[model samples]
Target: MSSNLLEQLRKMTVVVADTGDIQAIAQFKPQDATTNPSLITAAAQMPEYQEIVDQTLLKAKSDLGAGASQEDILTRAFDRLAVAFGLKILEIIPGRVSTEVDARLSYDTEGTIKKAHELIAQYEAAGIAKERILIKIASTWEGIRAAEVLEKEGIHCNLTLLFGIHQAIACAEAGITLISPFVGRILDWYKKDTGRDSYPAAEDPGVLSVTKIYNYYKKFGYKTEVMGASFRNIGEITELAGCDLLTISPQLLTELQGSTTELPRKLDPAKATAMTIEKIAVDKASYDKMHASDRMASEKLDEGIKGFTKALETLEQLLAERLKKLEEKAAVGV
Candidate 1:
């Protein structure tokens, strides 16, 4: 059953492991893998990953000098962690690893662009090719614009935290390499308000959101890839089975591995092309209008941005403590 399901779905979609633990990712043999601030933070706490974090901080201290300021050490250490994770992920997956930039830079076009390049440079320095890296950025209008510049330079991007058609349409217009709509996150917000467990896959609000984005891209011949992400359960995954890609967490990956159900293509570009989709673009005014039009998108965008920012701060704090310890050790001869 596993072999049959793999055969059926392998052609229609790219399977990516959404994890920071390289061991779990290796077990599933996903084509790609992704990591964000939260995953990195969680992984750093694992005893198995203590060496990875310590080594990263030690590298930061050496590169920045033992007396480097905490701010400098923290900034470089974050990069170290991301690169270390990306390198490990690349070793297990045949395709790219999506490493996220600091989410605090979502509204800062120049900062986002600079960090994206820094991430790509880190990968290259680690002996990974640029073609195998996809810098993940929050899908703010600023982020989309930043990605446009990066894409022109041959750096592909994975636009994440995307929750609305407006964001998707703008990303398509910007010619992004990929867009990751949060399927379960969308369903979560809706469920909180409506108090429901399930919806028909086709009519599920979250499902419809991704389907709309997919159809719009297909109808307009946009090359931007649609990768459904942030799923709450297997149902959402099954609902969007034919997405260009799906980044599943380790727990979900394990569930899929254990299940013997038939894997089918639920989202097809050919079928999408048969549906009517309005051609759209987001000029400055329209972007503002859409932001206002979708209350949930606006609120969630800010909330998600804040959540990632807080996590980044926590990670930075952790790196600083480690850096201080390493500095003391170098002085006293550990």
Candidate 2:
């Protein structure tokens, strides 16, 4: 009798905590939790998580041996940091934890593939089965190709930064495990492009975009699960009640926990199946053409990569400084 919107929503869709904050995951108790460079960087700065971050850095140094370069150590530490946080988060949530590959490798197919292998290896080494983890990669063409390879190897991938039907169709055709469509980011692009301040929830650009993608996937019977992510508000969440999954932020999770709204399911696969939606084939050439035309998708995808790359750079600098401090303190003891 006391269930809130979150409780009601969970009945129809899997809820994933879109955060790296372990405390938030523990509090929300979402089925899954996800992390990216930006989220992990924010979490690393928190005092409570200092021990975890330090341990990851120290372990990376120990594994790489004394002859490793600072850059090598930083790379190793950054990779380990993601799994370190994933391990901590998996301890609290019962479902999978998504860890992102380096954003800098978004356009490098081989680099992305290699990084994915290393990440899976690290997780497997930690005694965690690959089923409990999802390696997140950007939805660039190269990234998708890399995911296609990883999926065949029994390594699942969550394609992120997806904004257009072209990207969604490409991911689906590639047989990716899941795809993350950025609802809020799509809305952000539309608002800026049109110079509009608001949109009715039903007409919201992002909402409509995700609805279209969900319907298409169902109509065509693609198995790649759709997870609407990067939500700007609860309206977006409530509007996508029946999506396969919805990763929500702690702030919005708090709001949903506070209100006992009667949340209704808006996306029905049966209805989508009955609708007449034409399918689109997305190969490299068509993907390029469609991506070029959809200003929102192209711009947002590029911006998202740049933003995440900047965050990773900042995190590396943070680790380098922390490692320096550790070395200085150790020298003092000697």
Candidate 3:
């Protein structure tokens, strides 16, 4: 009998459940789970979580008073709901749960920090320790700066939407807890730009990008961990078997659990040390220039933030409708 690929991969990389589905997290038992506006929006529609949404809405209305505007009420409800989902996921997983700040706040350093504090406070109020929560921020310069401040307060952060080496270096310099370097999104940009149909796992651009970042991090002894995320296929996952971590969706997790393919350790600190890659320092000017020079990194980062922002808008709409129903019920004295 062959060992499950997921099991083998777990030996080298810490597998994080890249989802917001409570049932799915319970099934896979990943060490950690990440949630964004998109995942939260998708999970909010599930019948099982409807009560959570209702409860959050009711609490927001009760706390904010009846005079609060629908926008204010819905906004508070959405934040509570995000925390509610994270709270539930934390019950299933022993490790941390990453709750993202609003994507619209991606460029607002002060706003991001303020939201991070609020999110952490929510978790703390629910009796969840600060250590078990990661504030996920975009890799924008301002977002990274926000994380730097939050980290000083002992608030760990996961810098997301990262694509360029410049972003990784900056996050490390800021003392971020981790950086989720995307794999599939990078591949998508290259495929669209270069007109390449496919590339083998060994030569996959996404795979290589992550490998370089991992090598760079290890070579410099940066404390920030590299978690390969947004995978397109099992090949990308397998190629990064020795990554510090990998946040995988449930579908790929199932594929790995079912397959028995041998997984090789593709990255190592010793190997990275031997490589001749020069370390580059990144400041505001250099960071902007590097991101601009790399079309894929800049485009994808913008697209990712916009995508999350749209999803957040969708979630806000969902909460608004639910809030309306609640308001109607109260008006009718139900």
- What's the CA error at residue 111 for candidate 3, in Å? 0.8
Per-model TM-score, in order, reads 0.95, 0.98, 0.98
Which RMSD values do the candidates have, in order? 1.6, 1.0, 1.0
Instruction: Report the lDDT tens digits of candidate 3 across residue range 1-334.
Output: 8799999998889999999899999999999999989999999999998999999999998999969988888788889999999999999998999999999999999999899999999999999999999999999999999999999999999999999999999999999999999999999888888899988988888899999999999888898999999999999999999899999999999999999877788888889888888989999999999999998899999999999999989988998888788779989999
Best by lDDT: 2
| Model 2 / residue 67 / CA error / Å | 1.9
TM-score of 2: 0.98
lDDT tens per residue, model 2, 196-251: 99888888899999999999999999999999999999998999999999999999
Candidate 3 clash figure, as a count: 0
Question: In order, what lDDT does every prediction score?
Answer: 0.86, 0.94, 0.93
- Ordering by lDDT: 2, 3, 1
Candidate 1 per-residue lDDT, tens place, 159-235, comes to: 99999998998999898999999887787788776888777666677788898898889888899999998877777
Candidates by TM-score, descending order? 2, 3, 1
Instruction: Write down the worst ten-residue block by lDDT for model 2.
Output: 276-285
Q: Which ten residues in a row have the lowest lDDT in candidate 1?
A: 1-10
How badly does each model clash, as a count of residue pairs? 0, 0, 0
